[model samples]
Target: MFGDPIENPKGWPRVELDEVLDGIDSGKSPVCLSRPATPGEWGVLKLSAVTYGRYNASENKALPEGTAPGQNLEVRPGDLLFSRKNTYSLVGAVVLVRETPKRMLLPDLIFRLRLGEPQMLTASYLHQLLMYPSKRKEVRSLAGGAAGSMPNISKGRLLKLRVEVPPMSLQEEYARVVERLEQHRRLIGAQLHCLEAGLDSLQATAFSARL
Candidate 1:
C-alpha cells in the first residue's frame, strides 16, 4: 500500500475517528450460564478477549442454552474491536483480530469498528496508534460513569477522537517493527520456560539424593 516511499515527510495530517469509520456496532448479550457451553451451545466473547493490540478469541465464555448470537457478531480476522465499558484501567482497550479458530459472538459491551475505506486506515496501523500509552491515557480520561462503577466511553465521544494520519509507508514500517518485536518476545519467553524447567529438575535431583 506504500506509494513511492517518501523520506521523512513533514507533519502528518490529523483526522477525526468518525471521518474514517463507516459504522460502529455494539454486540448483544447471550444467555448467562454458570459454566462453559458445549460445542453446540452459544459462546459469547469476554472483554478480556481483546487487550491492547492483541485478540484472544479463546477467552470467550459459553452462553446458556436457548441463547442466540446476533447475526454477523462473529469476529473476522482484521476486525478492529473496542471495549465500550470496563474498569477504570481497561475502559478503552482496543485490539486487532489476527485469527479466529471458532465462531464466537461479541458481547454487549464491545464495539466493532467498520472502516469507511479500509485502504485509508490500515487496521494494524490504527491498532498501534490506539495502543500508544499517551493515547490510551487520553481515552481513559474521556471515560465517564458513576462514582463507584464501571466507566464507559460513549460512541460519540470515542468517534470524536482526533488521530494522526501518517503515510501508509510509515505505518507499514511500524507494523513490521511490531512483528519483529513480538517474535523476539516469544523467543525470550521460550528461553525463560526452559530455564525454569532446568531449575525444577535440579531441585528434584537434590531431593532424590537426600532420600
Candidate 2:
C-alpha cells in the first residue's frame, strides 16, 4: 500500500481492465429539473456525485416527468462508479457507493464499474487503488478532448489501462483498514455536529436575553 500501485511490488499479475471485467456500464442523460429529487421521485445522478471520493446521493437532479428512468442503470449499494468526462483534474474520478437511495439513475457522464466472473478484486480495494496518486495520473492521461472543452475518457481508452491486482486476502485487509478510518471520521463528524448545535443554541439564548 505504501509503494506505487502500478509498480506491482507485490508481484501480482498486472492486466488491462478489459481482461478483469466484462465491460463498463453507463447510463443516459435526459433533460432534468434543476432541483434534486424528493422522496418517491426519479432522479439522475450529477457529476458531483463522483467529483470527490465520497458518494453524495443528494448531488442529483430530478428526472423530468414523462421520462422513463433507466432501471438497468440504477445505482445500488456496493457499486463502483467512475466519471468519464469532467474537468482536467476530475476526468477519471472514481467512487464506491456504500449505500444509495431508491429510484436513482446514473448520468451518461458516469459509468458503473463491474468486476468480471471470479471476482478478482474487491470493490473497496479497487476504488482505493484507482485513487492512488500514481494510478490517477495514469488514468488521467487517457483523457482526450479539444482545448477549452471538458476532458473525456473513452470507454475504450479506459479499458486499456493496466492495473495490478493483489490477492483477495490482501485486498480484504486493506479494505478493513479503510473501514476503520471511515468509522473514526464518522465519529468525529457526529461530535462536531453536536458541538455546533450547542453553540447555536447558546448564541440564540444570549441574543434573547439582551432583547
> Which candidate has the highest TM-score of all?
2
Give a tens-digit lDDT track for model 1, residues 1-211: 3221122145567788998889898898865765554676667887778854578776778876566567588878778999989988888899877667556788889999888866667777887667777778877887998898899999999999887777778788878887789779779989999999999999998999953
Candidate 1 has which clashing residue pairs, if any?
A: none
lDDT of 2 by residue, 1-211 (tens): 5357867676778889988876799889999999999999999999999898789999999998899988999999988999999998888889998778999898999989899988788888889888988899999999999998999999999898988888789888888998899889889989999999999999998999953
Q: CA lDDT of 8 in candidate 2? A: 65
Give the poorly placed runs of model 2, Cα more than 4 Å off: none
| Candidate 1 residue runs with Cα over 4 Å from true position | 1-10, 37-41, 51-53, 180-211
Judged by whole-model lDDT over C-alpha atoms, candidate 2 comes out at: 0.89
TM-score of each: 0.78, 0.93
Clashes of each: 0, 0
lDDT value, residue 174 of candidate 1: 78
RMSD per candidate (Å) reads 4.9, 1.7
Assess the local accuracy of residue 155 in candidate 1 as a C-alpha lDDT between 0 and 100. Answer: 91
